[model samples]
Target: MPKWRIGYRTLKTAIGAALSIFIAQLLQLDFYVSAGIITVLCISVTKKESVRASWERILACLVGLIYGSIVYELIGYHPISIALLFLLFIPTAVAIGAKRGVVTSVVIMLHLYTIEGVNVEVLINEILLIIIGVGVALIMNMYMPSNEKDLTWKQVRLEDCFRSIWKEFASYLRFGDNSWDGKEIADAAAFIEEGKEMALKNVDNHFLRNDDYFYHYFKMREKQFAVIKSILPFISTLDRTLIQGEKMASFMEELSQAVSPGNTSAYFLVRLNELRNELQQMELPQTREEFEVRSSLFYILHELEEYLLTKKKFKPDPKRTKTVSAKRLNRDHEQRDTK
Candidate 1:
């Protein structure tokens, strides 16, 4: 099922329980009496939360059962007694599930207090009911499972990373042409940081899940990130390269085309491999000028290389020429309108 439908189901479950309990109380029926049934219904039906979240909720309810039992037995039969019991149990529950800590605890306590007086029998019954509810929920979830297995969060992260690199690459091209947008540079830096965090999260998830394909994808992601990191510092240097202006123009044009989603040439990859070899063989630059020239060239080349590698891995269909042609025509039209 779609993610939004899952979310809707979760919302419906929560609301249904709340509504059930409200109606029960309006009819002067025992609130706690209906709470367990509502809880079971909610747990069984909700589809948004992960299995891990469901497990946590079940554990928290079990803990709440013990706490509720203790309060019923130790405290006297007074409203103050139940209220004080709640004060104690709520914090403990919160500690267990910090995100929904207070809410979960309140649900448990309300279920207990809504009944006349807490006693050993009531405690045992409440505990059994909660366990039954959780069990039923787990069974239902197994049969009608959410599409958690199909979620490719790592792929999403990689896509974002590629987009950031593309933006930075675009900026480099503009800067080389002496019409650089300063805003693009700042935006690119922000996107780079966001992409870095996403990459780290993707790596962590891959390691935790022990996913081989995702792990390989993460390595590829790291290589791409490294290429971008190596080039960012050199973008300003390209602005000052008087002698290599023509060379820079040619290189930028090639890089831009490779990233344009229109060009099919694998020339960027070839140029990038050559640049990497040059960087490896050339002596370390001592002065700022030398560093700028070398670093700028390396950055542009590395970015182009990454784009080419990604494209080669996920090639577009040649039959989609019409799409590319249309995009080019639209771009030309926009440029003419601006002029």
Candidate 2:
């Protein structure tokens, strides 16, 4: 048996539907049950979506009423006339971007069909049902739970995964062997995809302002993760340990520590450029194996530079990032050389 639990949407839909029926019956409206059905259709995951759906349904129902009045009055309320009305109304609904409202409109049209005539009082009754149903939906949708904490937690998990991936890369390059099971790469990929989808849902929930920071952040990480994947094959091919690999491992360790939400890529880019300079000044390769390993290491460095550049483009908040001084960079470079 499937696990069963009441979700927020389920609870909201049940309450909204009941409230709509109660209000419509209290007003002594015709077909009060239609109000409840409309509420069920109009409720959505976000306030903006619910309101938009309700508006489309209400507009479609009004259009249905107008079409039904003219068609039934002329076509004599026959079965063929209902069919004819649908053929004409469905296309009109699609043209007006109200295709989602077609079912609700059909319900209203059927109500007119049952009555066999349209009048001011009857039209008002149908309109009241629409109002009650849509009003209840909008009211119920006002209580969206905050997902900021959830988003933050996912962000932390994603960053931790990235940190672990880079730490493994460093360990492999330095020791040429490590017992890392390589699970972090898979975990990071999952987190990036899941985080992106949740961020998009968050954007939909916000009607006034765009909360797209997490979305952009995840996208940046996704690109960086791809680069990491490409770098991995090259890392695995290294059979000969070189001194440059040790320096590159140290750089990877620094990068792993900086896997965060802040835009510290500029600082790392500076260190990267210095490392490139240092590499170019080093003695030429004396053997084929040494040459291959050095070239692969350079390719990995190039991809890492691209990864940093991708993050730089995102430009996360300056307040969240630490400032790196020229003196500090020089001192770090000198210390690495002494090692």
Model 1: how far is 320 from its true place, Å? 15
In the range 264-319, model 1's lDDT, one tens digit per residue, is 44666666666567566877878897877776676676565674575566434343
Instruction: Provide backbone clash counts, one per model.
Output: 1, 0
lDDT of 2 by residue, 37-84 (tens): 999999888877887898899889989999999999999888999999
Q: What are the lDDT scores of the predictions, listed in order?
A: 0.52, 0.86
Q: Once superposed on the true structure, which residue ranges of model 2 sit more than 4 Å away at CA?
A: 283-291, 317-339
Listed in order, each prediction's TM-score against the native is 0.52, 0.88
